[model samples]
Structures are given as structure tokens and as C-alpha cells.
Target: MRNCWFATPGIARPMSIRCWSSRWRRMPMASDRKLTAFFLGFAARHKWRFLLSVLAMPIYAYLVAEAPNVMRRAIDDGIMAGDRAATIRHSLVYLGCMVGGALGLVAQHWFMQSGGIRTLTHMREAVMRHILGLGRAEYDKRPLGVYVSRSTSDVEAIGETMTAGLTNLIADTLLIVFIFVNMVAIDRKLGLMTLVIVPVVVVVVDIFRRILRPLYDRIRTVNGTLTSQINEVLGMHGVIRSFHLQGAFNRLFREDNDEYRDTNIKAVSYDAAVFSILEGLSFVAIGGVLLYIAVRATGTEKALQLGAVVAFIQWLQMLFPPLKQMGARFAILQSALAAVSKLETVMQIPLPVDEGTKSPENLNLTVRDLTFAYNKEQPVLKNVALEVPAGKSLAVVGPTGSGKSTLIRLIVRQFDLNPGGGEILLGGTDLREILREDLRKKIVLIPQEPSIFEETVRYNISLDRPEVTMERIESICRKIRAHDFIQHLPHGYDTVIAGEGANLSMGQRQLIAMARALATDAQILIFDEATANIDTETERLIQEALDYVMATRTTILIAHRLSTIRDADQILVLNHGEIMERGTHDALMTRPGLYRRMYELQRHAIPDQ
Candidate 1:
């Protein structure tokens, strides 16, 4: 059903009522309908305010259309007849109509602005919620900057169109209609003659729009690309500075900026051309009316009155401004349509699947017949199986690209297993049957490079978990031997750390990670090379913390330093995504396997230790 709906050509995509539903579902594809149709459907959700805004337009247009007729009366009935009282009366009525029309215009602006804001706010929130629900695979496939553009720039463009562009479109259209009708009623011959220029003006405007549409789209695309590049360069500031590549990055940014500037210049040129043509056409329409009036005055049978000619001219002047503005408004509508199409493209990405129902206890970890690959061509972890009883420590040792980190990610459900690939069990319940949040609470994996936010040490350690008291945080920090360093900081536990812990040493960050792991109090802990790249003294401190953490919890350690995992209850040696050996350190050492050879080589290389 979903495929058929999206597959049908020229079909309008209906707005989903449950756009923010939590349940995982496939993202809807972009519709084939015109952009205006999609926008109208979006606005339909807030129909009452939209209708009020539309209603105000015609009311203002009616009052404006009536002003010229009142002036005709002031001239033909009062001024020419030399009746001062009648002239004043007609003049006052015209003034009242203009004042009333201005108030109606204000009301229309307010209503349209309010409606646009409400609708786009909901859209922004829904898109963000959908993004949050997506899995890690989606994030890995796209840059962070791409998502940022979708949320910020694209949304703002759509909002601007809805608030100002849409209102002007309706109001100008109605004003044109009202003026044309009044001109005909007052002077039919001149009205019909003036109507001849309408088709020519429309054709010219249409030609300009056709030229401008693709240019505007290209401009928007370039702007998004430039924004993405800027974000990427800024994020890699540390790496670029370290490698002395500042000039290279700057040159790349300049190239993108130049392209963006050129595209914008082209779009603006096209817009100005359109506006200039419309302005010239408006003056031509007025001249055509004057010529028609003069031609009628020479006719013997159907003479035009001076008052009626003046009224027709007034109506023609009023009509041309709206016509001129229509071209620009159409361009805004096109830009908004482009932005909406981009937004719909993002909305179509399916949410991550989570069908788990069972919450397990005891949390003894098991992996059976595990076979997986990030890509189909090569398997990363093949036919792997393992069992870890509660409170037992299992250490996995492997060379680079041996699927050590992949195994850890699978346990945490960062990526789902392939269909029929394998099954993971926690407390004898299938891992697929446990909610992800519940599974995470029972098992925590601390990566080698921990992420530190720009927040206080206390918040960093506990993550502001409600059940984790300040005393508990301090106790855990003390246990990990991080309390002393934290205390020595300017504000102790209250000290605000810089982003990624830039203000602290690598050892301090590792200590904080250890404290965070202990704070979770989960049944199982997996450390992926947690002590890598640290000094020997820091390694000793982390090892001590690891020993204390492993005493009562089931732990999985991926270590490059053999000494750190020598005391594990069981050790697994993996090579090329397959487990080649599994046994205790002493048992593995007695055998001529990969583990013993690697251990011997490491010990000989570092004999001083």
C-alpha cells in the first residue's frame, strides 16, 4: 500500500496526521503534485486562521475598489454641479473606506503570520523527533551538516513563504479582480480595451518565471552545499590546525563561497529583470487606457464622460501594482516549494525498528551463530558465539580489523543483526525481545574516546540521573581515583569542563569515563580499549578502577595491553572475525596458539616493565 501510494505519478501526498508517532514506520516519499498543492494541504491543517486571513483580503479589496467609484460621484455629481455639501460628503466616504481597508490589511497580516508560525513550529518539532528516532546507520551515511541544513534553512524558507508570500498572493489576486470588475461597470468600452493587455502581461510573467525557477533551485542547492562545507571545516578545526592545513581549508571554503555568490547573483538578476518588465507593462496598460479614452471622445454615438474616464484611470493604476507584485510573489512561492520538497525528502527516511517487549533480568550475556557485515561483500564478524555468566569477566584480544569493536556495537544494539544471522540472549531472553532502553540500562559500553560535554564534572559523571545522589557520584569518583584531580580544579566537582574535556589531560578523561561506567551500576560492562594511548601511571590507575568494577559485574574487555586482562576468568582470541582460541590466560599460555605467541612477543618487547 505504501509503495503504491508513492509510486503513482502526479499523486498528491497527504499530510500524515500522526507525524510524530513514536512507533517505527517507513518514511513517505515525496509527492508528484505541484508545490502549491502541497503547500495548501499543509496550510489546511490550520484552516480556520487561514480562512480568516483569506477573508480579510477580499474585504480590503472591496473597500479599495469602492474608493474610485466614490470619487467619480464626488466629481460628476458634486464638484461639476458646484454643490459643496455633496462634494464633502463623497470625499469623507472615500477617506473612511481607505482607512477601513488599511485596518483589514493589518488583520490579514497578523492572521497569516500567526498561522504560518504555528504550522512551521509543528513541522520543525516533528522533523527533529523523527531524526532522534533514526538509527546509527542513517547518521553514518550522512554528514551532520546536511541534517543541520534541513532543520534550519529549509524550514525558515517555508515559514517565510507561508507568512508573507502566501498573504500577498491572495490579496493581490483579489485586488486585481475587484479593480477589473469596477472598471467595466463604470466604462465598458475602456474596460474591454484595457483587458487586451492582460494576456500579454501574463505571458511575459510566465516566461520570466520559467527562467527563474530553475535558477532559484540551483541557488538553494549551492547554499546548502556551502553551509555543509563550512560546518565540516569548523568541526575539523583541531585536525586542520595540527596538520598546518589552514590555508587548504580556507581555499576550499572560498571556492564554495564563490560558487554560492555567483548562483545568488544570477537569481537576483533574473528577479530584477522580471520586476522591471512588469513595471514597464503596468505603465503601458495605463497609456492604453488613455488612448482608448481619446479615441472614444472623438466618436459621435458613444461619447465617454470625463468623470468616468478619470475613474477608469484610477482603477487601472490600482490594478497594475498588484499585477507587478504577482511576479515576485510567484518566485517566493517557487522557492518555498523547493524547500518543501527537500524537507519531504528527509521526512521519507524510515524510523529505526524497535519491536522489543520483554525486559530481562540477571543479564547473563550470550551470542549464538552471530554473522554480520557492514556491507554485503565482506563479513566483519562471522559465525561468532560466546557466553558470559553473570559477574564473570571475558577479555577479547585481536589485531586491528578483527571485529573486536563490531562485537561490542552489536551487544549494544547500535546496528541490528541481518535477518536469520544470529540471536543474542540476555538472562536467557532473546535480545530482540528487550526494549533498547531497557537493554542499555542493563549493559553499558564505554568507548576508548569518551565524549565530554561542556558541563560541570558532577553532571558529566552522573549524567544528572535522578537516582544518582551527589554522595554516590563522589563515592564512585573516589573509587576510580578521579576525585583528587577533580577536587584540585578551580571549582572541584562544580568545575565546568570544556568541550571534549579539552581543559583536562587524557588520564583525567579516562578517569571520568570510569566513574561514569560505575555510576550506571549495570549488570555488564564492555570496555573497548579503554586504556589505550594513556601513560603507564594512568593505565595503572584505570586498571585498578577496572579491577574494582569487575569484582561484582560481568565485564567484557577489549585490550591491546596484555597485562590488563591477564587475570580475566576467560579469554577469547579472535582473528579476521573468527574466534581461534578460548580459555583462561594460564591455559592459553601453555598452548601454542595465537594468544601465547602475541603475549610472548609483547613481554619480550617491554622487558623493563
Candidate 2:
């Protein structure tokens, strides 16, 4: 009766991912138990309907076998015995069973679909939560394409396995088994003769199927590639126009399109061959069964009765459809398996930073002998050390790729992984020792590419916090220059934004992001190159928000434009993962270092700076 499914390929859930502890602990990896259990749990709640449906199966099977018996009674007990009334009665009884079977079949199909969809919804929600709960580092390592497929196509493939697959498998398997059992029971020799064709059919079908599968898979891959081409071209339409490379882009598109067509045609040809072969073999086998039955049948009366013979023929015809359908769905099954493999690989990658189990109690912030690199061979930051006094602002300046943003990420615990490393401490508290929930409240990172969800601006900025007042929102928006745009629009603050705030400009989006960070109201704030994309008009407004943000919080400001951070309590110059210099901005500009050079260049780039 457990409501949890623990069948993740090979990955352990993050401790934070456990919504239910007892059920979570029972997760079983590397076994179908979790998968089977998931189904049982889904079916158990609605078991009464399922049980009723299952009961219908035997009735279906019995009626099927009974129809032949009725024909036998009509011929032997009625016609041969000279009882015409019995013949009519048996005929009517046979018709009634068929009608009942048809009704039961409808209910049975409905039940399977209902169960499949219910399971699909549950799994979709859980996977969505798991993806959402995954820390930033995991998201960075994977592509948007992968997550998109996981949620849509991949999950759908698995859902097919749950619903359509479940329905077909249950009906085919049970029906096939029922036929086999009854067939052998009635006449062992004839049944044995009919089964002679099974092994040959199975072997031939499997061989052709296996040969065709790879080509089908290639067709899928090529189609996805074509889709990728379209996405890339459309997403970068502005860039393409700027470069004046429409012809070149067209050429690339043609090549991908051609490849897709070629692969698709090849798969189609192979699939045609498989079905054609199945067709030829189907008649051969069925005809041979009839030959054997005809040879073994006794005097016309003693031989397999006409009714049994008709039912037997019907059974033979029924078998081919299930067999062919199972083959057709093989691709879906394979796709689900491959998706599981990819999902497993991702879940196995260790998250960059593992939050420890210790409690966080201090407000003191310090960095000591910090070292980090994107790769092992070349260090981006080396032997660096710095400190931020509680509630003070520290600015970091560096050239592009000089590791300034990396420094801020380390401080705010953005990576969540360990290989490319450094350590950050606050109030004698190692950042990793703090719980993630606590860390979110205490430390916040506002990235340059801030995300804007497709929702009302109020919902996007206020983040469902009931305490956020209209006055507070208006104040922050004004400070970030978003107030002008918000008020100018017809709907103002209540207007909804879609397509990731495509209705607004890039600068407008960043300002709204600033509002989001401000709303978090964390104790520590780090902004990594956040103001770079804002317009000159909005830059000053964002700076006002920054001023308010740093007044009573420990702040780490990363800047290429030095003017924004000149008033910072301390400025650290970072180079090659090392702290080359640290001092007040005015003092460092006079000292002949990277800070002075960056200041002069930025003053030219932005006259105000």
C-alpha cells in the first residue's frame, strides 16, 4: 500500500528531495520491484473496477470456447439427434455470449486507459518536482532539450508503456494463454499439431524485427536533428540577419532535411519488408495447421466439429493482430529504456556542493586560501583569500574570464558541485553546513541572465508572498526604473508576460529580476555582472536598488564597470584564481593594478562610469 516508487535507474535522491521519509527510505534501485510496485499502488486504489474487469476476462474466454460447443450441440445434439428446438436455442445462446463479450471488452479497454493516465499524471508531477528540486549545478550540466524531451516525449513514451502497452499486453497475453489451454484440453493431438508452426513463426519474426529496429531508431534520431536545425535557425534569427548568412543557413537546413528524408525512407522500406514477411508466413502457418487438422479429422461428424473448427480458425486469425501490434510498439519500449538510461546518468552525477548536516549559527564571513579552476590543469583562481565584514559591501573587479563571477558564485554557493572548487564561510560557518532551505533565506545570487516566468508581473516579482504589499513592489520597481514601463503599459503591474517576458525588453526583464532578488530579503546578496545589460537610463535606477540592498546586508558585487562599485567598502582584484590585490576602490586605483586599468576603460565605455 506504499505510495512511493523508488525505481530511479541508478541515482540516489538528494536528501532534500525526500517529501516522505519512511517511503523514501524504501526506494529499490536496480530491480523491477519499484516499477511493479508503482503499478500495484496505482491499481490497488481502483482495484474493485479492475477486479470486475478481470472477472470479465474468464467470462469472455468461456463464451469464446462455449460458442464452438454450442455449434457442436447444434450439429450433434440438435440436428443429428433430430432436435430442431435445441439447435435454435444453442444458436441464440451463442449470440448472447458474443454480445456480453463485446460489452466487457469495452469496459476492459476503458479501465486500462484510465489506469495508465492516472499513473502518467502521478509520474509527471513527481519528475517535475525532482527536476525543480535539483540544484543549479545539475541544470547547468544538462541541456534544455533533454529536460523538454524528458517531460514531454520521453514521459509520453513511458506512459504508452503504462496505458496502451498495458491494455494490449493484458488482453493479448490472457487471451493467448486461454486459447492455448483450451485448445490442448479439447484435443491434445490436433493442438500439438497446430503449435508446430509457433517456434518457426517466433524465430523468423524476432529476426526480422531485430534487424528493422535500428533503422527505425535512426529515423527518430534524424527527425530530432531536423527539429534541432529549425530551433537553432529560428532562435538566432536576429543574429543570422546581422551576419547576412541566410544562404549559408539555408544550405545547412537542406542538408539536415535531406538526411532526415533518407533515413526515414530507409526505415520505411525495412518496416515494409518485416510486415510483408509476416504476412507471407502467417498464411503459410495457418494453412499448414488446417492441412494437419483436415488430415487428422475423422468421419465428418467425428472430425473436429464444424463449430470447433470455425472457432479454431477465429483464434488463429486473432493471434496475428496482437503479434503485429506488439512489434509495432517495440520502438516506444526501446525509447523509454534509453530515456531511463539518460535520466539515470544525470541523477548519478554528484551535485557540486553537498550541504552538510551541521547547524549554522554565526554572522561572521571569511575566505581563506581559496583556490579553484574550471579544469584541473589550469587554475582560474589561485591561493585567494578575502573577508567581508558583516553588513558590509565588497566589490570584485577583473577582466573577462578573470574569475570575478566565479568568486561570487563560490561565495553564494551556486555551483552545488565539487570538482571546480573553492570554499566560502560566513560567521565562522562553512556555507555547505547550512541547510539549503536556510541558505535560500540567508544567501542569494542574482545572475545576469535572470529568468522571467510566463505569468503576471506581480506573481513573477512578488513570488506568491502574501506579505508583499503593492507599495513595496512599486517602490522597488521605481528604484529599478521598471516603474516607468509598468505604468506606461495598458495593464500596468497586473499585465501578464509570456514567452519569457518577450513582451518586454532585456533591460526591463533585468530590472524585474532585481525586484525578485530584493523580495527574497536574504541576509547576503551577490550580483554577478548583473547590471551589464541594462540601459544607461535604467542603470542608475538599478544602482539605487543596489544601494538599498547593501545597506544592511553582506554584499558581494562583481563588476566590469567599476563606477558602480567605487563606493564599496572593499575592492578585491582577482586574476588566475588568485587574489592579486585588495583595498578600498580609491586606494586601489592609486596603487597601479588591474582595478585602475579597468576603471579607465569602463569610464570610456560608459561616460558616466
Candidate 3:
């Protein structure tokens, strides 16, 4: 029957719901232990708040439990005896209990919510730090949306458990226990009879829980995928529009969205079913107690009094709400646990290794027997060798996918090399032996596409670096020939850049990247086709800047435009990750080699402009 019911939506993967339930039972206990430790860490940080919340629960429960008994005393001793004073006394006691209980509830919630905010803030910071620390390879394993979802939505889910679900679970349990004890104290036989439905309610809750656990997991998983799809689509909206792929992306998004909706509907169906059964059973318990009173009260020897009956009725009313709330809170707890598991997986990605402690003393660069591949079977670069003496320049030219970028990544230590693959050295120190922080300060890569932030031009150029003052920034901009254009902006260097440099021309954006690179005053400068996207006039200005900047700096220039590298001290014509030819521009062009062919082709293509 469970299998048939779960089959209606057909969302569960790998197996039917029955199979999933059986497998879930066999899941290892270690995961539960890990999750327990996860919550324990949360408690350890905010122990006082959690303790206060727990301590207030029993106080609130006791007051709530005694309220109905107070009403019973008023009914039997005052209303039945026609004494207004007794009724007024009991009424006053009831009011006091209500006020006291409200305060306890308020205290419990306030402490829990405040603690949750602090915990959530710390948790988000940890996740962001982890994401930033991840290696370039780890980032390739998942989409940006997955990280965003985990950091934002998943963290919030766990926060909800801390604030509302866990707090309510404890409070409701205490409330139920106190209500049961008071009922039994009033009339043991009636109290025992009312509980006949408890076993059935437990069974129903268990079955629905099994049904919803996997469903909730599915819903959360689909939400992440849907979010990733949305981010990808939005981030590539221009490309999609250029390729007329709106309909294709729309269909893909619809599929993920529909799957999300279907899983949620299944979860809601089972959730509603649980609540319906709980409500029905509550009514049954009440009706059974009333019937028992009627049957037993007919005798001359009364089995129950009117006061007890009234109190019992009132207690039943109080009991079922918490009963119903337990069901809702359980759903929230389950969702939180699912989020915990997802976040745990993300946090387990290996952090980048940065144990290098040595610093280089010079800018001389050397690559020896350099070989690499994203995977073992398909090598991108093999047995590559190159060198650039301090204060000298080297130019690398190759067709796309000839491992030009791979070589650059290797030189910058973006990917760690295998033991026998290759070695890159700066001065006499191996690249792997140099501290990453120090290495970043000395080596900078300016790519064809510039990254501009939504800040003033001054911030974009200086990047808030302490060393790059306003004077230094102006000097660098002037060297890069960008000072004049920047001064013409509405606010000069203080003008705020639009997102992705929408307000700036392609040439202007590239010029800003150049100015930033120049301001660094680094020993070695790497320009990877920096002028590829700029106009001819901007390229000319950038070339002039490059001449000045490269004169004293050890530079690695990777370019497609052969004319730009004509004056490079040594030019290497790279093909298929190997140095096919190496010589000065005039020497290489004089021979019938790859460099001469490429130079001639570009020279003819440009039409002497």
C-alpha cells in the first residue's frame, strides 16, 4: 500500500518509496553520530541560551497544566455551591498562571531566536571562508548556485531548527507530559481510557515520517539544482540571447521547476494526511472520554465528578494543539537535518595546500620539462621548457588550446603539479616553495577580460591596497595613458563603475586593468592577450604603456597579435605545448617557420591599418 501511494508522483529516484525506506533503515549509524556532533557544537557555543530555553519549558508547561485544574475547582466548589468568592479566587489564580506562562514562553523564544542569529552569522562566515579557500579544481566540480544555495538557504534551514523547531519540540513534549500527569491526577480511570488512541497516533506519525523524509530530501536537492540553473542562465543571458537559446533554456528550467513542484506536492500530501489523522484521533479521544463519563456516572456510586469531566475536556483541548504542533515541528527538523547533510558534503571539499614558506629574491623565471593534464589520459602540455632572465621579457604565441593558458596557470601555481610532471622556478626557488601570499604580490596576470567592481574608479585601480596611494594611482594611470579619459568622467577618478563596467568602453576597461597592473610595481608582469578586445587606438595606447612597464620588469607576454611582440627580447612560437621555434622577431621572420607564417597571415589580415 505504501509503495502504491508513493508511486503516484513518481519522483523518488533509484528505487520506489518502499525500497528507499528499507535502505534508509540500513543506513550506517555513523552519519547520525556526525549529525549529533554537529548539533552539539552549536549547543556548546550558545549553551546558556539553550539552557535557559530548556529551563523555561517546564515552568510554562506546569502553569498551563494547572490552569484547567483551577477552572475545575471554580466549577465544583463555587459554581455548584453558589459561592461567588470561591469562583473569583480560582479565576484570579487562572489569570496569574496565564500571565506567568506568557512570560516563560516569551523568555524561551527570545533567547532561542537571539542565539540563532549569532550562530547563523558565524556559520555563514565559515562557509564563505571555505568557499574562498577552495582550489580552482574543486570549483569545477559544482556550479556557483550550489555554493550560494548552501550558504544562504541551507544555513537558514539549520537556523530555523535552532530557533523554532528544536525549541518547540522540547516545549511541546513537556506540555504533553504535564497534561497527561494532571489528567491522571484528576481521574485515573478516565485518563487511562483517553490514552487508548496514543499508540495509533504514534504509528500514523511514524509512517508519514518515513514517507516525507525522502520526499523532503528530494525537494531540497531539486531546489539547489533549480537555483544553479537560474544562475547559469542569468549569468550567460547575453550569450543565450546571441545564440537564440532562450527557448532551450526555458524548457530546461521548466523541467527542473516542475520536478521541484512535484516533490513538494508529494510532501504536502503526506503531511496533510498526518495532520488529518492526528485531528481525527484527538476528536476520538475526547468523544471516548465523554462516553466513559456518561456510562459510569449513571450508577448511584459515581465514577467521575462534573468538575473532573470539565477539567478533562479542557485538558484534551490543550493537549491536541501541542500534538498537532509536534507534527509540524518534526517536518521542520527533518528539513534541517537534510540541509545539514548537504552542507556537510560541501564543507568536506579539500582545502588548497599552501605550506610554502620560502620567498624569492629575484624575478628570474624558468620552466623545465613542464607537463600537465586536467586528467591522466589526456595531457594538455608535455615536456615544455622555457626561461626568462631577471629584467628580461619572453613572448609565447600559440593557437587556442595549444596549452598557452595551461602554461600560464602552471607558472602562476594555480594547479599543483604532480611529483614527476614538471618544475617552475622563480630565481633559484621552486614555485611550490614560495609562500602563496608573497607570490601573489610579485606576480600579476592581466587577462583580455578585465574584472571591474561596482565602486569608484579609484577603488577599482587601487583595489584598496595600502601601497597604491592616490599619487601612485595617478602616476600609473598616466603611464598607461588612461589618466585623460578618467579625468573626463563625471566625477573623474571618483566615478562609480556600473556592474561589469557597463558604463565603460571595452578599451577603457582594459586600460583600467593596465593601470592596476602598473600600480602594483611588481618584478614580473604577465599580460595574457590584454589588448585582444580593445580598439586599435586603445591598443596603441596600451602598447605604449606596455613598452614603459616591460622595460624594467621581467614580463611574460602571451599574445595573438604578432606585431605586439616584435620587440620582445626572445619570442617562442609554441605549438601543441612544445616550443616549435625560438628566436628574435627579425630572425624568426627571415626563416620559413611557423612564426613567419603567422606574422604574414596577421599582417595581410590587418590591411596596413
**Top candidate (lDDT):** 3
* TM-scores, each model vs. reference: 0.85, 0.82, 0.86
Query: Which rank order by lDDT, best down to worst?
Result: 3, 1, 2
Candidate 1: tens digits of C-alpha lDDT, residues 1-609: 111111112212222211111111222234537545655666778888888888899999889888988888889888988999999999999899999888888888889888899888888887798788888789889998778888897788788677766787788788888888988897676677788777877788678656765665665566667787788778988898899998988888788788867866776676578667766777777787778668767876576666776788788777765665465556556656677777777777888777998899767889999999998879999899999999999999989899999998888888888888898889888888898789878888888888898999999988989988899999888887888889999999999999889998887897887788788868788999987778777888888888988896899999988888988999999999999999999999999999999998878987843
Per-residue accuracy of model 3 over 1-609 as CA lDDT, tens digit each? 133231212112121232222123232345977975765675578878878888888888889888989988888888887899998999899899888887888888888888888878877887889999998778978999899989998898788777867877788799889888998888887777667656676677668777777886677578778887888988999999999999999998899899988887777788668667777787887888888788777866566767888889888877766654455566567667777777777888889889899999787898899888888877888888888998889999988888887888878877888679989999889998999988888998887788999999999999999989999999888877899999999999999999999999987998898788778867788888876777677778778878877786888889878888888999988888788999899899889999999988988898754
Which candidate wins on TM-score?
Answer: 3
What is the RMSD, in Å, between candidate 3 and the native fold over all Cα?
6.1
Error of 3 at 506 (Å): 2.8
Query: TM-score for model 2?
Result: 0.82
List candidate 2 segments past 4 Å from native.
1-59, 79-82, 184-189, 255-305, 326-364, 373-379, 416-423, 604-609
lDDT per prediction?
0.79, 0.67, 0.80
Candidate 1 RMSD to the real structure: 7.8
lDDT of 2 by residue, 242-332 (tens): 9998999899878878876786566556656766776787787678767767876753535775656665665666556555544434444
TM-score order of candidates, top first: 3, 1, 2
Lowest summed-lDDT stretch of 10 residues in model 2? 15-24
- Clashes (N, CA, C under 3 Å) per candidate: 0, 11, 0
